[model samples]
Target: MPSRSCPRLALLALAATLALASPPAARACSVCGCGDPQLDASDPAAASGRFRLQLASEYLSMDAGTEGAPGSTDHLKQVSLRADAVWSPAEWLSLLARVPYVRKDLTTTGPGAQGPGSSLSGLGDAELGARITLLSRVDLGRGRSHGLALTGGASLPTGSNDARRGGERLDEHGQLGTGSFGPYAGLHYAFSQGDWYAFASVTGRFHTVNGFGYQYGEALLWTAEAQYRLGQRVAVSLGLDGREAWADLDHGLAVESTGGLVLAASPAAYLSVGGGMWLGVRAQLPFYARLRGEQSVGPVLVGGVQYQAL
Candidate 1:
C-alpha cells in the first residue's frame, strides 16, 4: 500500500541513518593549546618512570663601578629560592636536582660607602646536577623539534663571607657568598610550530675563591626566548638575558666586567585549583645593567608551582 517508489526508498533510508548518528567536530587548538613545534629532549614529560616537581622565586639587583671609584657606586640585592627534581631514567635520560636560597644586600655610594649600611644573609650557594640529551626534536618531524643538553655542576659555599662594610671584613668582591668552589655548564635549544616557540641558552661559571683574595674566576650566561600560544591553555613569553663576570686580581688586575638585561613574562596554563598546580608566572625587568661600570634599574618578581604524578 505504500509505493511511490516505496516512499522514495524510505526517504533515502532515513537520510543514511541521520548521517551515521552525527557528532564529530571540535579541534581548532587544544591539546593543552597546541603549538608544539618540536625540540623536546625531555623536561616536559617524555615517558619512562616520569616525575617532576618545581618551585621557584628570584629577584636580583645591581649597580656597580668601583675598581678605583669611577663615580663610586656598588649596590646589590639578591633574593632567590628554587627547588627542583626530575627523573626519567630513559627516553633520553633525565636526572636533575636543584636547591638554592640566597639573600644579600650591599651598598656603596659616592666615596664607596666608607661609613655605614651593609647587609648579607644566609644560605646562598648550592647546586648539583646532571642532564643528557644528545639529539631530539621529537625525533625529527611532526612540527620542528631539536634538542641537545649537557650539564655538570657544583656550587656550595653556604653563605656569608664575613659580611661587613665600614668596619672591614667584606672582601671576595664584597662578600655575601662565593667563598669558592663553583663549576657549571649549560646549553639548551628549542623550536616549535603549532603555537610557536623559540629558545636558546648558554651558561658558564667557574670559580675557586678559597683565600678570598680573588685570583681565578669566570661567569658568562646568555639566554633568548620567544613564545606564543593562546588556546589550549594559554602561553606568552619574551626574554633576553646576558651576563659577563670575569676576575683575575692578584697583581696583574685588569679583566673585570659585569653585565645584565632581562625582560620576561609567562602567564597562564599553570593553574591547579587545589592539591597542586600553578605552574607559571615569571616577570622580570631590568632595562639595562652593568657592574664594573656602574648602572641601575629594577623590577623582579617570580612565582611558581608545578607537579606531576599519575
Candidate 2:
C-alpha cells in the first residue's frame, strides 16, 4: 500500500534540498528589472487570475580588475529583497508593482585600492507596470493553450543616488538608484500543452541622464524557458537568458567598462506548497560574456514565495 505520509515527506525533502543547494543569482540585471517578471511558478499569469503576490530574494558577487591583468583585486557583493504584486481586475489586463530593498558591499585590493571599500543598504527603484493580453487561445478539456502579452512600465527615481563613503560620493554603480527615470517595454509569450510549458520574452530599458550628468547604459534583454510539470505539485525549468547593454555616457562621452553582452543558462524548480502558495529557486550560470572593458561578472541566485487566487 502507498503510504499517506510519502507525499508529505517528498515535499519536505525537496524544500530542504532547494534551500541548502541554491546559490546566489537573480532573475534580471543587478540594478534593474531587465528580464523575466514571473516568479515561483510556471504559467500562473496564463490564468488571467484576480491577484498574485510574491516576495523574492537574490544574491550576486562580482570581481573587477584590469583587462588581461594577472590578478583581480576588487570584489562586490549584492543582496536584494523585493516585493511584487499584480492585480487583474479584468481577464485581459493586469496591473503590477515592484519594490525592492538592496544592500551592497565592495572590497578593493592592491595599491590603488581606496580604504578597503564601501557599503550601502537602502531602498532601490520601484516599478509600476501593466500587462495587456493581446492574444489568447484556451483548450480546457485538452489542457492546451497559448497566450501573448504586452508589458510596459517605468522605474521611479525613489532610491538614494548620492550615497557617500569617507565624504566622497559613491559612483552611480554603487548607489541604490540612478536618480533618473527609466522606461521599459516588452512582449511575453507562453504556450502550454498537458504538463509541459514554454515561455519567452523580450524587454528593453531606456535611461536618462541623472543630476550629476551621468547616464547609465540602455539595455536589451531576452529570455526563453521550458518547464515540465512533475505530477500536480512540482515543476522543473531550464532556460536561457541574454542581455546586451550600450555603453554608459559621462557628460556625453562614452564610459568604458560599462556595457557588454552576456548569456547564461538557468535551471529552476518550483513546488506547490498547498493553499495557493508556491516556493521556487533559480540559478543563473553565465556561459559567455563579451564585455567592452575590464570587469568580471558572477553567477546569480534567486528564490521566492508566491501566493495567488484564481
The candidate that achieves the highest lDDT relative to the unseen native structure: 2
User: In model 2, which residue pairs have backbone atoms overlapping below 3 Å?
Assistant: 24-300, 24-301, 25-300, 25-301
Off by over 4 Å in 1: 1-115, 118-133, 137-141, 152-167, 171-181, 185-191, 198-209, 212-226, 229-282, 285-310
Which regions of candidate 2 are displaced past 4 Å? 1-29, 32-34, 37-49, 65-73, 139-142
Q: What total of clashing residue pairs does each candidate reach?
A: 12, 4
* TM-score of every candidate: 0.28, 0.84
Tens digit of per-residue lDDT, candidate 2, span 9-66: 2221122111111122221145443245432222334234567677778887766552
Query: Quick one: best TM-score, which candidate?
Result: 2
